[model samples]
Target: MPDFTTDHTEPAADRVERFQAAASTAFAPLLVRAHDGPPFHATIRAQATGGLLVSDIRTSPVTVNRPAGRISSSDNDVYKVALQLSGTMGVAQDGRREVMRPGDLAVYDTTRPYALEHFAAPDGEIRTVVIACPRHSFAAGPDALREVVATPVPATRGVTGLVAAFFTGLADELPNVDASGTHLADALVDLISLTFATPPRPDPSALTARMIAYCEANLSDPTLSPRTVARAHHISVRYAHRLFAETDRSLASWIRSRRLDRIRRDLENPLLAHRTVAAIAARWGLYDAPHVSRLFRATYGVSPTTYRRAHSGGF
Candidate 1:
């Protein structure tokens, strides 16, 4: 990992400016306002994890903003997840506001306008650790992503606790390590995946939220093969397959399962009771009757027709 460690110990007049310059390059353009007296003392230790930047930071009371113009000029299209190591930090973005305390973290998109206010406690300057996650690393679609964006993800317990621990310890664990961060990257992405995931779309961002969105929108087109998917996304077929490989199912299997799930739902719908199993299957681009039947039974423990019949009629 590439490392950068800096401490702003310059005279009070120049420290804030120097800190602002260093911050802009390390993260993004921000209008930084100091709340404490001048000659601000700050520290930032950041390292690149190939796909993400993990940093440990301590700063005097200040407010940072990524305004609309700055967002436009230098949009990395990445997301920032910051863990409050000590003191209090407040974040506001996308019309949502949150106050994060120790053991609390929040995520905000760099592509959007946001503000972070770090307050100095009686003890000292606010301390925090932040992770700069490339947008592509997130697998959740835009809608699902919204649920956590600018929202506080508590790290007191559950899987979120584990994620918090990872971010908290990453700075110390990764320094001077020469190996690639493939596994580490996957873990960060996976935890972020879990943090933002919800029911009705429980399927994680196996192929990234964008790729999954494209696949879902064209699921019924029949022409939506891996090659076509790759072409549409301007990515190679091998890359597309590799993205799916990150999940428990393959690309073809995922598509098939999604199609079957839709077909099953429609079959059980009273409005679609008049539709034949074959028609329902075709509507979802599943034309192979025997193959569909076999998979459906294997998945749901009942053939498509039987499942539909059992659920369609009144008791």
Candidate 2:
């Protein structure tokens, strides 16, 4: 892929204006204000890999803002995930704010008002790799996603750490890849989804959320019943059922539904075409072939075989 970069080493008087224009063009239409005084400096080196836009940015202290006027004129409706490589950045959106240090990650939507305050260290420059894509790129609800915007995702552990490492590796090797890099882009999106799919652990008393997290992690275990789930979380089976009383289904039903959904998705995945429907069902802990077929048909209004056929263009 070809690389695109902006050079801000022009006339010192107009460097700030030039940098602002370049920044807006590379990311989105927004206002960039120099943090302290004159002689603003910044650079944006970007590459388009498949459907993803990856950019490495190095800039002095500055605050980027997306105001209502700019949003009304052009709302891109895209999500920007930034991995702080050096220095710190403070992101504010949807009433949430987070200060992202080195190795920290943050996400924000471009359709609404937001601000990014980039702070440099003694080196006088902050570095980051920003990935931008349409909001629909991930299978998540807008409202539900908005709730987590501007929240800092620590890169020291768990899925976020893995994602941070992947981005760092990609940025390092991006100059060598000669193709579209679509597979890499897809993996990045998948990791982002996985990191966010797990509920945020704001407090320990979020037992229901903990249960959902545990269930999602162990969905492939056929023995992942309410008993196992409760035991894993150190709660009683009766209390586990009570925790889900307000939900539409019982704990067991919810797990089964999730497993079935995974199976249905696999059935439609072209990459999994070689696998049989029974095998896919078993992979998700639905070992009973007849029961899986019946439940799948009832949920999707089509048998697994028919669904795969339709998705694969074989019917």
Quick one: best lDDT, which candidate? 2
Q: Residue-pair clashes per candidate, as listed? A: 1, 0
Per-residue lDDT over 219-298 for candidate 1, one digit per residue giving the tens place of the 0 to 100 score: 78887777667655534355568788888988778888888889988987999887888888889887888888999999
Worst 10 residues of 2 by lDDT: 1-10
Model 1 lDDT-worst window of ten: 1-10
Cα lDDT of model 2 by residue, 1-315, tens digit:
234333456665476677777767766788877777546677676777767877788888888998877876455567898999999998888765657788877788888889999988667778899888778888777786775678666778788889998878766766664348788778889888876653643443487888899899999999999867865653435557878987889998999999999998898788888899899998998889999999998999998999999887673
Computed on alpha carbons, the lDDT of every model, listed in order, comes to 0.76, 0.79
On a 0 to 100 scale, what is the lDDT of residue 84 in model 1?
89
Q: Alpha-carbon error at 41 in model 1, in Å? A: 1.2
Error of 1 at 277 (Å): 71
